[model samples]
Target: MDASFVIHGPSIKPGTEIELISNTDVAPTAAQLLSVEMKNVDGRVLTKVMM
Candidate 1:
């Protein structure tokens, strides 16, 4: 998630699904924090982050 997309006010519960739409490339550091592999819609590996 981008810095701008971070919600600072409340705690989000588990199982909550948030949709993120970004046109700009998400930094490698950010992808690592999210623990989700950054890839294109076609399943191409853009970056691999540890889960």
Candidate 2:
């Protein structure tokens, strides 16, 4: 399966393209954007997507 998307916003880094990422990372990334820190998260934040 191939999943793709486009994220465009002030917070998203321009022309960012991460070749490796986990489905589990979605929640952590969202939490970070909401300024909420999760404890012992199963996945890490996709910081490469951020500016």
Best by lDDT: 2
What digit string (tens of lDDT, one per residue) describes model 1 on residues 1-51?
A: 454443221233333444553534345335545566666542222222222
Candidate 1 wrong stretches, greater than 4 Å: 1-26, 39-51
TM-score winner: 2
User: Which TM-score value belongs to model 1?
Assistant: 0.23
Task: Output the lDDT of residue 19, model 2.
Answer: 74
> What's the CA error at residue 40 for candidate 1, in Å?
8.4
Q: Write the per-residue lDDT of candidate 2 for residues 1-51, one digit (tens) a residue.
A: 767756667889998888767777888988888899899978888889998
Return the number of clashes found in candidate 1: 0
lDDT of 1 at 14: 37
Candidate 2: segments with Cα more than 4 A from true spot: none
Displacement of the residue 22 alpha carbon in candidate 2, Å: 1.0
